[model samples]
Target: MKITEKTNEGLKREYGIVVPNEDIATKVAVKLEEIATKVSLPGFRPGKAPKDLIKKKYEEAVSSEVAEEEINKAVDQIIKEKSLKPAYRPDINVESYKFGTDLSFELSLEVIPEIEIKPFDNITLDKFVVEISDKEIDERIEFFANRQKEYKNSDSQGPVKTGDVVLIDFVGSTGGVEFKGGKGEDYDLEIGSNSFIPGFEDQLVGAKVGDIVDVNVDFPKEYHAKDLAGKPALFKVTVKAIREAVKVEINDEFAKKFGQESLESLKKMVRESISHDYEMSSKMALKKRLLDALSNEYDFEVPSKLKEMEFGAIWKQIEDAKAKGQLDEEDKDKSDEELKAEYQDIAERRVRLGILMAEIGEANQIKVEQKDLNKAIFEEASRYRGYEQQVIEQYTKNPRLIEGLKAPIFEEKVVDFIISKVKLNESKVSKEEALKKEEEANEPAKKKAAPKKKTKAKKEEE
Candidate 1:
């Protein structure tokens, strides 16, 4: 085996590797001998086939496999000897290869840039803490009570009105032909909830009990069901019953409906839920500001390959949003090139932060463990309520999903460690103020004006 240095540049290394034909022939012969023992041949007992015959049968396949293995081994040896931390898979170009000839290939790889971990004690970040007041809890309870509004039979023998729940049987047809999923029986629909097709509920406002009415409606152009979208449909509806809504009193019985012991317990749960939300928002906001500060502090060459990968992901999402006409207002006026330039900076920042965070985590020996993963997985599962086991099972069986969770969890752990070491200038803020702070943390990225091609970007002021 022979290796030659082709190129040595910043974050990029290229090498030319060669393996002698004897080495390749040796491995192929050894592989064929192993195969000969297990493989049966015509009129030949297992393990009794001639080396020439075995070579004749499997030489090409074995040679290719041997070449690939040799190349991979050589690449690994190069990385090990050079102490290289590749940003992505090394690109292999086989210039020459044959069964009985020397094999040579060019290997090129981008190494991750070395980052110097800086002290974080001097950096002061505002930690917004919002107090969950009793009034707020009461307001949330009131909202829940409103959502739990009970309906009873209307006393007045009058037509259905808004805020009334009605039971109806209907068959919706377009062009006198009934469509799939257009029929329902004794379905409870709350008028003015807008849960049904637009104008479909409004037409039922004046419908009385036992009234068989013909309601005509046009589905919106952007409706989820493509077949029914922008199409006119007539529904032959029979009013079954009308029930007026009454608010459920926020008391013990109301609390029991949610499986809570008492009203106090329910309020406690609400307060905890609100507290968790505010704390999460605070941490997120603090993380953004910290990352922004870190980006400002650290200036290093990012692996161009990583930057390109990140940019590809961001541009794909941007392209999707643009196609949907949902591009951000700040981005709407910018050309694709301009947006690319701006978002390239963002991608650079993200890659920089990720690299910095990873280095810091490694320096401090921070790691994600099985328990951490289990907790995160269980927390995710809890979000789906009754389908917790199914969600857990899906995540447990899917290694890719588990891999996805590892990074964020590790990032969170890294952030926590950083917060512990840094100066957190805690500020007690109103929930709205805290939210505004979170939004402001992102303002820097949106406000940065990226320079055109071949021009250096202006540094964002802290």
Candidate 2:
């Protein structure tokens, strides 16, 4: 057996392998001898068959199997001897193979690059400290009170007014032709709600019960129904009745309606909920600042394989959005060249940050506990509301599903670990300002989305 390097470049290796004819013959002979002992025939007893007979019947089958096993072993041995970690399975080129000829092949592969970790103490980052404000708590209380409001028939019922619910029957048409889904009976519409087409609800104001009136409205230019978008429609509306909402007294009885003991208890629950939201928002903002700082601190070329994988995932998402008719305005206008350049930059940044974060976590000996993974999974499952138990049970039964739950948790832990070692300066900002900063940071990437090539299948459905 002989092995020679064909090429050695950055993160890539190729080699030529050759097994001499002598070795092939040696292996074939051994296989033939083993088969000879076990051979049986119609005219001969078991273990009494000749070598010539075995070779004639089973030589081709045994030789092929032996060659396959030898090639696999040779490939594994070469990788082990070179201390190579392939990013993907090797591409094998079988140059030649036969019973009495030399077996030759080429193997080409990309290797996982070695990571050089930097010290954590040198990194610096900013940490946001957001205090839960009293105004926020009051706003939450007002929202809860609105949810508890009750509706009653209006006392002054001469005409329906804003904030009143009107029960009506109506048929609508555009250009004197009735459209599909344009007719309904006894529809309860809330005036001033803006739930219908623009100007539809406003025109219903000051209308008396049993009064049939024609209401005109223009459908929005971006209406989901393509046939009716930007079209003028007139509805023959008859107001049958009118009702108004009355705010419920925020006392113990109102609190008990939601399964709470008292109004004070309900208020306490709302405050806690608001506090939790603030805590989560602050933590996320702090993480972003920390990551940005770390990225600026370290300098290294990210592995191209990592960048390609990330880019592929992002491109898949873009394609899916285009399929759903949810492509953003900027995406609809982008050329292929512009989108590729933008997405390529995003891929490089993500890969570089990911590798840097992993290095920091490994150097610091950071670890994610089983409890943390389980808690994250449970929290995610709870988002499904009533199906939480079933989701939990399903994940618990599959190890791969549990791993899917743990990857993001582990990534976040690594990020947090880096944040802990960095010098973090606290800065306080208003909610609106922080949101604006986040949006500004995302603007550049948002403007470069690629206009996907529309598929015939998608167009047919549309």
Candidate 3:
């Protein structure tokens, strides 16, 4: 057996590995001998088959097994000897092979880059603190009560009000030709919900029960249905009924309807739920800002293999977005070269953050403990309400999903650890202010419009 370095570049390596025929023959003979002890041929007694006959009959099968073992062993030996850690699985392409000749292959791999993690104490991060207010709790209680509100039929119905949900049947036609999705029976539409065409519901105002009226409107240019967009149409609408929402009273009885024993209990629950949500949001926002800061502070060359893998993932998402005509308007304006550059930056940031977070976790001994994982799993399962056990089973059985869950947990633990070590300047801010900062961090900077292309970009490229 022999190994030779064919190429050595920045993190990229290529090698040639050769396993002599004698080595393969030895392995095959050994395998055949093992099989001879437990196997028989049609004309031979068990364990009595001649070695030459066994070789003749099982040489192909034995050779295949031997080749696989030899290749694996050769690669492992070479990697171990060179002290090389691949950033990804090595690509092996068989170069040449023969029954009586050496087995040779070319190995291509990207080595993991050495990471010199910066000191944690040197990293600076801010933790946003939001003070829970009673006023906020009252506002949330009101919102929760609104969800339990009911509707009652209006008796003094002279004209339909903006807040009323009107039930109506209508047919739309342009020049006496009806279109699809322009007609319905007993459709309950909230007048102010903007669920229908801009003027569709307004036209039903002053319309009484069983009143048939002709409403004319034009669909917007951006209407989802291409055929009716921007076309003027007359809808023959028949008002079936008029109804209004009946706001629920913020009383004990109303609170009891929400599974709470009393209004006081409901208010307490709402306050705690709101506080918990705000706290979680604050922590998440701070963590994201910290991650961004870390990215800004550290500029390291990520392994090419990792970058390609991450880019492949991001590119797939880009292609999916393009398929749905969901490409970012800002990105669409850029040139192909410009978009590539931007996406490459995005790929780098992802890889950088991944490496940094993983290293931080390792440095601090942060881990997803069984208890924490079980709690997370239970919380996730509780989302389904009654089928928690099923959800838990589903989560535990799928290793990939478990890893996905572990990522956020690991990132959070790392972030918390960093926060403890760093000089955190805690600044108390309103929830709105924290949210504003979060939005600003996520918002992309405005750029000049892209020049028109001679030809439309390929769907995937776009």
* Steric collisions counted per model: 0, 0, 1
Q: Is candidate 1 or candidate 2 better by lDDT?
A: 1
lDDT of 1 by residue, 88-164 (tens): 89999999898889999999998888887878897888888997788899999999987878777776554888987
- Top candidate on TM-score is 1
Candidate 2 per-residue lDDT over residues 1-462, each given as its tens digit: 799999888877899999887887788898888777787877899878877888888888887887787789888998999999776688889898877888899988877667766666776655555555767766776777887666666656547778889878999999999898999887778899888888998888889988898999998988999999999999999888786678767778877876789888877777787668766776776665555555566656665666787777767766777678766565578886776676787667666676666666666787778889778878989899999999988888988988786657777888767666767767776667667765664454342222234321111000
Ranking by TM-score: 1, 3, 2
The estimated TM-scores of all candidates read 0.88, 0.73, 0.80
Question: Which residue runs of candidate 3 sit more than 4 Å off their true CA positions?
Answer: 167-189, 195-203, 212-241, 244-247, 440-462
- Candidate 2 vs. true structure, TM-score: 0.73
Off by over 4 Å in 2: 20-72, 98-100, 156-163, 167-188, 192-207, 210-240, 257-260, 316-334, 362-369, 397-400, 436-462
Error of 1 at 461 (Å): 20
Candidate 1 Cα errors over 4 Å, as ranges? 36-38, 155-169, 175-190, 205-210, 221-230, 239-243, 447-462
Candidate 1: pairs in clash: none
Q: Give the per-residue lDDT of model 3 (tens digit) for 1-462.
A: 888998988888999988899989888888888998988888889999998888898899889888988888878987899899777788999988877889999889987666777776776666677777878877887887766666666664446777777778899899899887778997777778888788887887777777898999898998888887899999999877787777768888877877898888988888788768877877766666566667767887788778777666666766666676777775667676776676676667777777778876776688898887888899899899889999999988998888788877777778888767777777888888877866675564122112112221222111
